[model samples]
Target: MAKIAYILLCHKDPEAIIQQAEQLTAAGDFMSIHFDASAKSESFAMIRDALEDNPNVTFAHKRIKCGWGEWSLVQATLYAIEAAIADFPRATHFYMLSGDCMAVKTAEYAHQFLDDNETDFIESFDFFESDWIKIGMKEERLIYRHFFNERTHKSLFYWAIELQKRLGFKRRIPGDVQVQIGSQWWCLRRRTIESILDFIRSRKDVIRFFRTTWIPDETFFQTLVRHLVPENEIDTRTLTFLMFTDYGMPVTFHNDHYDLLLSQDFLFARKISPDAKTLKARLGKLYSSRGIDFQISNEGRSLYKFLATQGRAGRRFGMRFWETESSLGRERELMIVVCKKWHVAKRLTDQIRQETEIPAIDFIFDEDNTALPDLGGIQSSLAKRARHRRSLMRMLFEYFESDRLIVCMDPSNLDLMHDFFSDRSMTRLLRIECDFTDDYLIGHARRIGLAGDRTSQLTLERLLPTIRNDINHEADRIRDAGFSRHFRIRQSDSTETNATKLVEFLSLPYETALKLAQTRQLFDD
Candidate 1:
């Protein structure tokens, strides 16, 4: 009978917190909530009244004014943890959670897993050796004292660091304890939590050092769990499934991510979208029910890996282009039309559609950098569309499933266009203006919303001369690759003729196109 006490650090969304508290208590678990002191008193009152009847629920004795990357986060957690321990004497384990977090797995499974493993589930590694510190100062985070809030007073915080660095002032660890860094989310056994509390009560110097340490919440408990718990009884991983973006922001789970979250071995997931009523309800239902036994699935791992490495090596070199939603066995001709001018692309696409049966889509990457208008039904966050550009191209290939598909790409997507330059499976046609004019450059910049200010326009004016050379070089590179031919469409060249030539080029297979490109004029412009 391993009962768990869930200590939740909440700042906002009182209803969501109440829902979580009810779900956990119904599953036979105790909850201790630490509401931020800065939050509205009305909201806290609402939560208090909602859970007043629930005997398994308790509020922190003291409310802490929490701030991001500040010591107050750890203070809030400690307050809740203390309250949980005092109230839930029968609880054998303590799990840390946020207001946004929801249980992805049932409590029965969690209790069983904890009972069988008999270890603390936390992420802990040597602070110096850890690559987990993706953003901000690493060694400096420990060496320099951070008095200002990192998020709110970013300038002052960095200024203080620089001042300390220039003064050659550094703080030393109070004790012989090893410094560790890890995710703030953790689940510790009762004995381990007690040991941590005991360490805190005894070590005043260590507490003082951590008080000024930058982002101590991520390090404080992570480091102490290592020194307090026996190495053999510690599992260096979190039971909470948390994923961050390329920009180091937490990924918010939504209704569509329910299946993905359910596949994980994690007990809970955080940063759930507040408007995700269906996701919250479904996950709440899972809290009390005997959900599927925990087992790591390869597909689940791959999905998480794909998301984790978005805009990185996972999607690098168009690796995910063919893998994502592509029908491999089906035969289809994919033609990517690369052009610098949107008007020219639209004209070419209009001509192609009127003259041939090929599906020619223009401006795939528009103002929002989204493919939704061109290829409907696949809605994604603006960040994903911009970051994972190749994923959108793959989706285009998969969605249409037409025998012949032509996608009109703007010069802004030059990186994506270059990715398919060498791939012989698809046919690529390049239409670029080698002669750079002030009007043309200015117009292009305006279209892309880059020339909003005179400074940016002046900057573009300076880079105008090299733009012609870059396009010519890319055209030569395509010719050299021998995989595709670059067709230059001048203003004098007839759009109808170029469209006909493109139609003929698209009709040929990769081998035929390669041979035609090398020998005779497959594209006449």
Candidate 2:
């Protein structure tokens, strides 16, 4: 087998990294590891012991201690590549891989690809163009120095960013380097890797410029390479395969991505750790549409059994309804819009309806039915004088088979739903909240007083923080029933923000949500 240098950046997950190393080293590849300096010494020792006396393996003495989006990532790669060059002088290709990534292909196939495309530098694309430009992520990612990794510190960093955003301020991009980004994983010829390291050492200013930039590992080599290597030498197609979340997180592949892995010509796939998450991801993908035969591995079966045993006592709701609820391209996504009272629900519902033009089924419990506004729809519309909250929801679910759906509940009346209709599992909840003072003055109590409920005076008492408790209780209930993710919209939020929040909850695209907010009538802010 041809000598390939695999540069693995390991933080935690030493076991998984060991498996990753084992997969490639069998092909007689030289593996160079740079363990995160912050990692437990015992774990690092364990990783070293696992690959002990493997003449093909080398460890970098200069370990870097950095978290996500730090200069340490670049340093670690540099150190690993430097070590690999010194130890495995004969290695033809330098491959950048992560601790979470596993080799999907045998070494023979990988070696063949390397042999065929010897000069092609894998994954060369202009990061500043296309999607990043449209989404406007460059301002946040490229300009800002997001060095802090701790929770509180990161929160403060974002808080300062928000203040800066309001004040119309921009962070300085350190040097005169053409800034761009790309997928961090790549297989490059030995010369390209050496050129990158050389450029870094020679142009300390360029390296220093990228240090304060977010996730510089993705950009540093990519930006510098175009200057060093010819455009014809760069092959934009990456050998590493990945699927990302709405946020750019790589979806952890398990058995579900087995077919995808086989279908691709890629050599590596990332973030495959822990059988449970991978199983769940596979399950989510498999069950994302109409019934397909999916075999459950022992680990998968165990995961399902464990999930079933979790949450509060509830009837086993099959995944069929969930699939229908979660399926993409459905005419309308359903949102269970629960608020404290009639006026509050109307206000929040208006924010959603006006911004997104999505039909909202409001659970308005007006005794005289005069105050509640009419809504439009087929046999399922709640636009006319509303029924009691529970009955409306019961009737809605009876006929509603998950098409453009939302439910509204007042937390004060959660007792009406104790063990009844409301407890039936919803895919997610979007709580609509109002200002507490306004809940008494402009919302529940005021409306109750107008409607002449004998308990109008007590309504304010019940309604105080009633929204939060009810929302929290409902959140707990749904999560207990295994519908864990939820969102919120407060009175303080603008209509557009609320619309985006609701759209996200319903899994609608950001563009579609944005169009709704922009084109739709009566947008808030």
Cα lDDT of all candidates, in order?
0.71, 0.59
Writing each residue's lDDT as its tens digit, candidate 1 over 280-374 gives 88998988997566555525446655645573334221223224323322344556666655655565555555545566666655535422322
Model 2 lDDT vs. the true structure? 0.59
- Model 2: residues >4 Å from true position, as ranges? 132-136, 149-152, 162-176, 245-249, 256-260, 276-525
TM-score computed on alpha carbons, candidate 2: 0.55
In TM-score terms, which candidate is top?
Answer: 1
lDDT of 2 by residue, 1-525 (tens): 456899988887787667667656765788999998888999999999998878888898698786665778888888998999999988988888876666655566567667877565555566666453334246576666565642214345567667767886676664566666677887888888788877777887676667777667778877777778888888876677675432222345545546545445566666563554654344223311333333323242233344434533323322221221222222334455555545555555555555553455556432333222111121223332233333333334323323455546555444433423334444456665555444344344344454235546566465655644654675465435533456776667775796688577767777665554444332222
